[model samples]
Target: MKRLRLPIPFSIKTNMILAFLGVSLISILILNLFTIHYFSEAVKKDFFTISGEAQSRLNYHLDDYFKQIASSTSTLLKSDLNQSWLSGKRVHTSDDIDNIQMELKRYVAFNFPEIIGMFLVNREQRIISMTGNINTDSLSYRNEPWYDLPPNDSLVILPTHRTAYPYPQQNGTPVLSLLIPIYSTDDLNVTGKLVIDITFSKIHDILGKSALGKTGFFFILADDRIVYHPNQDWLGMGVGRTDLASLSFDREEQSSIQYWNGDKMLVSVKRSTITDWNIVSIVPFDEMSSGLKAARGSTFFAFMIVSVAIIAVVPLVSNIFVKPIIRLKQVMQSVARGDFSVRAVDDAGQMEFQQLGHSFNRMVEQINELLETVYELRIQEMHVRLRQKEALIQALQNQINPHLLYNSLDIIKSIAYLENVPRVEKMAKNLADVYRYTAKYAESEVTIGDELTHLSKYLEIIRVRFPHYFESHIYVNEKFHDCLIEKLTLQPLVENAVKYGIEPKGGHGAIMVSAFQDDAVLVIEIADNGPGISEERMRELNERLAFITNHVKDKQLPQESLGIASVQARLVLKYGEDYGVALHSFPGRGTVVSIRIPYRSPKIG
Candidate 1:
């Protein structure tokens, strides 16, 4: 599964702008939310306050209207015509009773224009002074609940009901009734009842004159029934069946918000002390908050405009801040591509940018100077290598006279053969092979097998010279025979073992040569059993080997350690610091020289 990577990576300028805008937007959003919340609460409080005030006004108006009705009823009770009729003193004949009835009707009409009709009933169950239709048979006044009320001075206000007038214009219209019980002046016994029918139009007029919002309207509830509503159809309906009935209405003057039919409404209630009725004003929440809604829209539009302005300005501001950094980056990229001639432009007005540009220019100048010095040193090293190779070829040319020495060795071998000296002839032949191998110095690298063959021939000549002084052993693996190695690498170590380790120890020592592979490297060990180097001298010799480059350049190899130092230097030059010769020795025991090099087999192609 491959990992997904972003197509366009985020840059410093973009991140900085995002951080700035994020903080700004978050802070602004929080402030706006708090402001809107507080504004909404304040508007709600104002709505409740206005509803409460409306309730107060409606209550006062209704109270005054009821008071006027009560005063009119009280005045009619004291009228002479009403008392004379009740006592039956002024009505002996029908004509006399009719005159008294007409006079009483005129006075009531003139005094109370709100009263639509008036009726009087006597103790004998006889009706008189009836200005509107009065059904004598269907009156059933005796069975009426108001008719049996215990004699009380105050007039009793009744719920609205339809009139039974025969006149089409006056019949079936709802009216409020006021019942006044007549009593004898001396005994206080109830003798008759005075009924005043007040028109429903009067109550409607009072409520219709006032309002809350567009949809706000008032209704009068009496005895849990809607006595007066703006919608005539709702009149006489039970208050318990309407949405308003679910609201709390215990107080004389109260207001609250409630949901009705899924719409929020503000309900204000005022109870009338005169009629024991409630004047409820209902206004919708949306109507009441129309202005606030408009304000909210305007605020949102302004916020949007500000947000757009911030978005447009943020990039410009971030660019202003990052421009100098961008210029420096471009210069650095140029420098990385080896174009050191380019320098960061110092056109930025800020002091920091100017200083940074100057520093970058100085650094590039120093880098260029250092590169020139390194280039010169590399050229000198190549020249020295070329001279070394030339010197090796010239030394090989000087050994070319080695063919005359070979001829002379052949002559001696011939004489030795005639004298029957087999050892001498064998010695001469081995010496000739050694000379021929040494003459091939131009070959810097050879197969380990070839080098080992030359080493065996050289060892044979040494063994003949030393007789039983030393012995040599070769334990290299055949698999590594074709592996390439530096020419004369093994021969030097073996020569050193013979001259320093064996010959000095009375020519009685053993030399062992072994080669093997360790991972990706080949290791060769040359071991000798002879008087070994002391600890102090070995330390000095290893230190000299470590600085072989300086030793080669200064021609400072010590005479006694030249062979070992030369081999260590050649191995280091051929491979690297990791491939070199290491010496391990114990005084009076033995010495071992191990060479480590990268393993390589000859390629066929």
Candidate 2:
């Protein structure tokens, strides 16, 4: 598979924005993670501390309730009914003892509302005194575990069991018993055992009051057995079957997290000082960490909002930072294209960018000033070169004048001696006319008619010198006779054809000078049927001409093509780059030199 790429090049602004957002998002995520972790730990710590405190308070209340039961037992032992039974002095008959026991039961019932029933059993007398309704079948005093204990004053707390004679208000509920053995004062012998039954409902009331957080509750355990629980089904079950069964009850109070009912929970255990039972408070982990979870959610939401804000804000900030640079780049591009007038604006938002813009503007201004100076220098150099070329042309023309005058005088003298007076006169007159025209050089531009008239006279002299050696033709329209052109423009081209083309080709060639109007420009072409320029030489000459026109100051005129280069330079000086000379040549055929000039009528003096 081909990898996809962006169509447009990445810009600095986009890159900066992406980089900033990437860093910001990562920071936000990290901060949010840490915040959530810290928040969760803090909430868990607070929750456990609160639950442990609640369990401790409940244990204290339950311990106080058990102490009240022990105190009630002590009070009963000090009662006259308990003393008389132990001493064997209060009653002699069964009728009298039963009446006294009935009165004692009423007194105990009126004093302790939590008690379900009370019983007094004597092994020596083979009798039992009981309070409330009794079931003889369930009340086996002789085989009871507490009855077998060694005689003692201290009370014994028994495990919870169903009461044999449950109070009507107790509704057949289970009860926790406290047994106090009665002993004789003289012999310190075991006389009787007083049993006080406390209903499970009272313990339930205490456990229920110790409420934890949501979904938290308390249970009472006696020696690792659940004695009282809110759920009746858990009551009487071994503590090992429950969630908190693994808890070590070595300490007076402890708290920890454990899996309860297949769910993690925060469990706290507080031991009761009275019964050595544990008050276990359980709060499911989910419930205890609810506040932490909410805090995490809130932190995540805030992070998302901040991340989005960073994403949106980064681009705008990058743009604010990059806008001026973009403008500066555009201005620099313009300057590279030779538009030195352009400059960067100094209105960037940042101080550094503003300074950069100011520097760019200063650089452009300096470049523009240097370019203006260079342009003026180039114009001055062109003027100086043109003056030098004109001077050289004048000197060449002066050298031609004396040579032609001498040859013309020799031809006239010879013709005169040969009795060819008319021809001699014609030749001499043309020679005088050529000399006169060459001598007059005041005007820089002339009409085509005047230039052509001078050219015809010079050609007539040339014909006189070498009759039938070369032929010349002019095919200029009369309408162009008044058209303005550079002076001596056509003369040098004709001279070149006669000397280089016609003379080199056995002095027998045809030279044609033609003029025509092409659009707004006039074209003067000089064609010669002589030994033509070779393809290589023509290309070299054309390249030289182009170089001269393109780099006017750097290129020097070729020595062999001085006349042609001079004409081309003058024409460019007058008409600019668009109007110049062109050469067309073919080997062993002919050469055509065409001069292109903008057509304009001769200016009046």
Candidate 3:
């Protein structure tokens, strides 16, 4: 008998179905993983967004509360009409307190149902209620825990035993009490306590109603101690009992949202800016992220099912087709390990392998081009920074020595005083005016009139000091007085002209300072008829501008160089570089330093 043969069934259609099922399973598994992450992020984002909105609403409530109080107090304070009605009344009649209570109750019913009651206690600690039923005078409420405890310590919102009424089933309700001290109108002396009783149930209703997905618990806390909770029994319970000490909201940082405890529950709490009462909202980990947790679990189950199906079907298919995939995974791992040179090698001579190889080469080329461009930009950025540093240093070194110049003038006054001369006193007065102007408006860009006044003082001081070094004349067009110029700028230029031009050329030499506005530019020209600069020296000066420019470019310099550099720098920094110092000179004639600045007027709001 011949051996029985086992037939192998192979078809293109059968293979295609196996491949399609395999790819679909893996795709679903990967997509499920991504979905888990996406849902988690979306949940956290929504939670934070809602928390912020809740915080805003809480602030609005407090702001409205304060505004109503302030408006009432201001009305009482300003009312001359109500003086006789409010003065020394026994068993109070104005109904101002009653009206205030009614308004407060209305506020609670409409805007802030969170508030329990607001009441005022006078200097005698008399009790008054808006409900109009509970007679606190016979109840001896002033001496009770509610009134006495608050007046003694105004800073703390003291938690006390809940008060019960006379009737049956009128069990004590949990209430948080705050005391705000008010003073006499004139003396600022504390005369009463603004007693506020906040019901825990009301707060719970407001916070709990808005809590949609999660089981949210909120409570009023005084410092680290819990004053009240939604559950009436938990009222006056210490926070340590609830393991709140381990929470991220410690004694401090009660103002913002925080995540606390082992479960990663998000907590948001805020302290009242006026009363220091803490408002806290707690969400448990399970309740807060129930949706996301469900999503993750569902995804995990789907991934496992798909993975198992893929594992079973893959082996029965072609080992040759799967072998390239295994090689591709190894290449990916190598690349992850920083081996960019790693490439997939195809042994089966498949078209897919050829396509992958081409794709890898193209990616490498793009990466290289990107790296080269980044490197070039980095170098160019470094060059620009170097230039900036050089410019900054040059500016710092050329700062004006204003103090030294002032000291020299002061010395001249001292010398003339020792000589017992009256002219010295007159000169000193003029010098004082100049110094005052400089010191007073150091940062201000002054008007032409102010600058001219400051210059006249300087010229008077120089005349007293040198007697007759040069004749000074200033010609400011009346129309240009409205034009603005940098304060004390003209003084420095005039000083330079006198020292370099007039004094060097000897006595009887003249100096001219003129100001005029032309074509939207304020021009001030200082010309001296003296032996001016030589052409060779002018060329030398222009060439040496590079050195000056480089020095100005260098950012590091001593504080003394700060003024000239500062003045030049500020002119450029404020009005742009083109609107500053220009020089023109010729041998045996005169030198002119022209300053052009943008015209601007002071604007009133």
Candidate number achieving the greatest lDDT relative to the actual structure: 1
Estimated TM-score for each candidate: 0.44, 0.43, 0.34
Best by TM-score: 1
Ranking by lDDT: 1, 2, 3
Instruction: Provide the overall lDDT of each model, using Cα atoms, as 2-decimal numbers.
Output: 0.74, 0.72, 0.61
What is every candidate's alpha-carbon RMSD to the true fold?
16.5, 20.8, 33.6
- Predicted candidate 3 versus true structure: per-residue lDDT over 250-364, tens digit per residue: 5333223345656656566666566566666667645666776777677668767766665576566646455666667677787777666666663344487667766765675
**What tens-digit string does per-residue lDDT give for candidate 2 at 1-605?**
99998675679877776666677678867877787667656755776678677877877876677777666555556666556765667555556557556755765667667775666656553445454222243344434445455545666787665543323444445667777677665577777777677766777787777677666887777886777888776665676787556665554455566665588776667776667777777777777677667766876687678668867887877887788788889989999998987878877565998999988898888888888999999999999988876675454344434434645666675677578687777777776677667557666678899889999987887777678676889999999999988777788788888887888867688889999989999999999987789878888879877876775444444454337876776677667789889999866888899999889895632
The superposed Cα distance between candidate 2 and the true structure at residue 469, in angstroms, equals 99
- Cα error of candidate 2 at position 253, Å: 2.8
Candidate 1: which pairs clash?
none
In model 2, state the lDDT of residue 581. Answer: 90
